[model samples]
Target chain A: MRDKTILLVEDNQDDEDLTLRAFKTNNISNRIIVVRDGAEALDYLFGEGAYAGRDLSMMPTLILLDLNLPKIDGFEVLKRVRADSRTRRLPIIILTTSHEQEEVFRAYESGCNSYVRKPVDSAQFRDAVRDLGLFWLIHNVPPPESE
Target chain B: MQTKRFAGGLRIALVLAGIFLALASGYLAGIREAQMKASGPALTRDLTIVLFGQTLHLRLSLSALGVTIIFVLTILLAAAVLFARVAHRRRRQVEAVNRKLMREIGERKRAQDEVIQLNAELEQRVAARTRELQTANKELEAFCSSVSHDLRAPLRAIDGFSDALLKDYHDKLDEQGQQHLQRVRNATQRMAQLIDDLLSLSRVTRTEMRREEVNLTAIAREVVTELRQIDPGGNVEVIISEGLVAQGDARLLRQVLENLLGNAWKYTSKQPAARIVMGTCKGRNGKPAFFVQDNGAGFDMAYASKLFGVFQRLHSASDFPGTGVGLATVQRIIHRHGGEVWAEGSVGQGATFYFTVY
Candidate 1:
């Protein structure tokens, strides 16, 4: 259960609430650490700034990353995370509102585990978030040395 | 100009020499007296002679001097005449060459002027097109991103919170309130579909095209398979012709077939037995056109022209739910491939969409 922690990086408050509700509705009982921006996400991941005294060994097993963010964008965050050995093997899923094909290709090219378009329909969005949670948390096998 | 001027000078010199020869031979006495003084002993000796019964004191040396003078003058005159003729011929040749050069210069000047005019026109056209493209591109970019990010975000919140109200406040609210929330959710979903459809239409215009040998039959079959998966209860009989191939972007062409076949499947929902046929046949202009024929709720011929216009629908939302952008997208993609699309249908009969790609 400790190793099944999740990191959710989202900017919009409504989307954040909806995502939390989706996980709760789907009965995914993993501990989720939410970050408002890409900078906070990096800080949380590296245990720097606001999270300086926090233990670095307890890394989140899965990350739900949003493409559009303030202070630092999603692509940059993905690059910096993949560059570091500590968070390199973490499963990162891109959840974005953009339906652009070029953006999708770029996200995959930048090394995201999965890409999900945040559908405007509530049920579809909820279903998508639930599927991502179930697959990454319970079913799919993470890298052996990731923890 | 130099050759022509040189020829004129030579003619003037020739004419002056001719006047000098005339003065010396016919009227100039001082020149003849000098010639006689310069004669040698044999040229000066004169003898008595009789000619035609008239005795004339004829100095033999004098006759010899006259004959010698006459012979030299005749030779000089003949040489001058020959030189004049040669100079005239040379001048005519130079004049002819000068005229040819002037004509060539005129032609080159005309060609250069034409080229400059053409270049100016082309530059103007290019500038106009660039400005138009820039404006269109900027507008499309703003519209697409705003709709993708901003518009959908609010709508999703509304839908999500509405669902929450229905789920969490189920007992507090009356039955009608729950039903109203459901209606609101469905309305949001429909609006989301409209947004998606608009985005798709924009993408049809914006997406870059890659032409290849696309197996159209394979695409149609795949679309049909997906359609069947989406609606497992659909019992429509579909018949696709063999070896339907085209040179175009496969993804766009797949969208084309999907929209057409999807519409066919949708309109034929009320029919007991629906039949759809996809094949190639000659179009109205006698060109080979790929057609999708379906026995469905057809349209009137008078309103047919409005079918391909964006947001124009012949059927009501209750009967045939659509954003009315599918046919417009199909037309745009077909036009992008240097092709055209048209449809023919009579009310209560069926609809057949014919498209040709080059």
Candidate 2:
């Protein structure tokens, strides 16, 4: 349990607060890192900029990405993460407000692990977040590391 | 131009005549001089002449006879040369006219070809512009959807916190305070519904359509079954026409039936023994029209024009609940298939919606 961590990259403050509350309500109980935009997310992931000299071995177990963001959008962040050999196997789930089929297909085609829409109904949103945590944080197995 | 050409020909003819007369006179003068200067034996010659009723004999000068014969030959030769020159000039003028006509015909042919080429180019340009405009329209629709989608986040927050206040501090709030919170929650939810409905309306227009032979009868059967499940307590009867087949997009046609039949189910909720019929009949111009009719709380005919407008409802929200987007969507789909839709009913007399797919 102590080994798992989740990174949330969302720009909107309201959405960030709601997502945090939903995670807490579901008893996810993992180390959660929040970044405001795409550029900050990259810095945190690559241990660069403000995160310089941080231990790169402690990688996030899961990534929740919002497609609409400032300073490089979600697709670019997903691309750079997958391109790096050190972080290619991390699970990247797209969490956004759009349920359009074209956008969903595009997310999967660009190598996202899962796609989920942020429902306007808060109770439904909590249930979706809980199911996501149950699957990724506990039930599913992660690839073994060199350590 | 014709008069000028004729005048030119006349001037040449007159000049040739003057030269001919001058030459004849000069030859006659020379003949006279020769006859006057010659001896009698040289100038004279014996001659015999025969007339209609008498004969005559005379002696004539040889030189005068020779001079007369030479003068006659010279006159004839000059006349022949002059006629030939005029004929050659007339032939050249005719050739010049023919060449002008040929040049005119060639120019007209080139101009005609240029026009045809221009028409083809214009058609190509029109097609390209139409495609560009279609692309721009699609982008605008997408932008509208995005803005509406982003609006839901704050609304969810408002509704969620209202629930929080109600759930966490139930005893701390007074009755009026609780009611106010409930109202706030309701308004937020309604706004969310509006956003969803708006997105769907735009989606229907933007979606691509595929035409095939669709068994609308079967689709209606499925929609009615679903409606029955939703409103199981109502004792509503549904009658569907057999073999209602048409050419259209199957998915979109299914949506049309759902909206129409769903309305039929919803409006008749107050009836004790409700009857809803889905059938085909002859419409205006004798075209086959499909209709969904119900013995429900029908609306006044005066407000019929506003029935299909977005969020427009003839009945009060308390009486009947709807987003009023269904009929508009139906109209769009049918119109896409080159069809028309209309309705007919009076107050409390039940309503029938008729639509044709061309």
Candidate 3:
């Protein structure tokens, strides 16, 4: 439970299930901690609301965020996280169903480390997840903790 | 200088006086003959005289005949003058009528020229507007291309990373964990399709149209074949009447068929057996018309007006996958050909699109 974790911020249940499956298929060992919306994801990350009692020192290795949500969308969440001293350098990946050009550029402008679009074919979906998990887990080194 | 009416009155009066004079001359001749027959020594004159008691009058020989001769000469002069006056008045009236007629003809000619000039100016203005619209369409197409390029970058990253994640982690994830990965991939693919449709709409509007005689049947058949490739399992029968030709841009006509027939294929995916037909008939304007009829998931009649509007979709995204640009593109193409396009459908029954390039 204390090992490196993944913060998956997604609204749709089906998409959330698929992400979990992608991680498993790719053989990633990190524990996936999912929130249903951007607000909940922030709450969990900052140890606020229901997660007030949770330990703040247990930081996740990566955050996968969806752009569109019920309230407090991913851009606001990313901005808030980057502005704060404690979680400014946290690796945030934008994983959404939107392929709008403005959305991609905006995500990068707002300090997201990476962006991803969902795929249709199940096999192709599985393959994309496999590659993504491998690259981040094996190739990319996590940034150091902020002061 | 006498007025024509005054001169006419003078001539008539002179003519009456001459008639009396002629009668007097004849009477004088008669009296002279009678005198000669009676064997008179000398016949000097015949006269009738009137006098008062203090006045005396003498009659001269041949005095009546002299007066009659002068009277006849004056009457002949008056008659000639009267005829000339009447001729002069008639000539003046005729001249006035000719001048008025010429003026009226000139006015009508000017009005006709002005009308012709106005029509030419209106045509020039319409040409200018068409050019402006074409330029606007080009700009929109450029914008769409840029958007598509920008959108594709992130999509690639999404698919790439998810694949990496699934590849590097397998043993640790439970069955529930595995399902989440699949959903992420599905969403990305749907987004890519929407972007593609946006690009297609932009392309259709921007491209310059080259019109020629096009075979509608060939386009329909080709589109049907393409649709079958996309949905192999979906059973749909397509009937196309061969050799129905029209004056239009071939590429645009092909796009129109693709959109209409493609919609047929997509909507009829749920049906056990689908029927689609393409044929020609007389249009509402009594012109040659083409039609695409399909038995599919048709839309509500109330929302029919929105069918050709950009991004206006009647069905939900979760049910029917589209960016809602196909029919809009089709409409634009048909309109550019100087033709008309319309659709008829009811919920769950079917849809038919009719177009004419007259």
lDDT for each candidate structure = 0.87, 0.82, 0.78
Candidate 2 or 1, higher DockQ: 1
Residue A51 miss distance in model 2 (angstroms): 3.5
Predicted chain B of candidate 3, TM-score versus the true chain B: 0.60
Query: Is 1 or 3 the stronger prediction by DockQ?
Result: 1
Q: What is the DockQ score of candidate 3, to 2 decimals?
A: 0.06
Please identify which of the two predictions, 2 or 3, would achieve the higher lDDT against the true structure. Answer: 2
TM-score of chain B of 1: 0.70
**DockQ in order:** 0.73, 0.39, 0.06
lDDT (tens digit, per residue) of candidate 3 on A11-50? 8766677678767766886888989887898889899987
Instruction: Write model 2 residue lDDT over A22-63, tens digit each, in one string.
Output: 898889888889999999999998999999987988988899
Q: In model 3, where do residues sit more than 4 Å from their true spots?
A: A1-147, B1-141, B175-177
Off by over 4 Å in 2: A52-59, A79-90, A135-147, B1-98, B113-117, B120-128, B131-135, B221-242, B271-276, B345-350
Encode model 1's per-residue lDDT on A17-128: one tens digit a residue.
Answer: 9999999999998899999999999999999999997888888889999988999988889989999999898899999888677678878888888998898888888899
Write out fnat for all predictions, comma-separated: 0.78, 0.41, 0.11
How would you encode candidate 2's per-residue C-alpha lDDT over B1-358 as one tens digit per residue?
6567556766665666667566666776687677667733344677776778678776755544555465556556655665676677778898999899889999989999999999999999999999998998778667864766578878878877787788779999999999999989878877777777667677677778899999989999999888888878889999999999989999888888988898888888888889999989998869999999999888888888887777888877678777777778877888888888888888777889888987
Model 2: pairs clashing at backbone N, Cα or C within 3 Å: B43-B61, B43-B62, B44-B60, B44-B61, B44-B62, B45-B60, B45-B61
Candidate 1 local lDDT, B221-317, one digit each (tens): 9999999999999899999999999999999999999999999999888888999999999887898899999999989999989999999999998
Model 1 clash count equals 7
Q: After superposition, which runs of candidate 1 have C-alpha atoms over 4 Å from their true positions?
A: B1-139
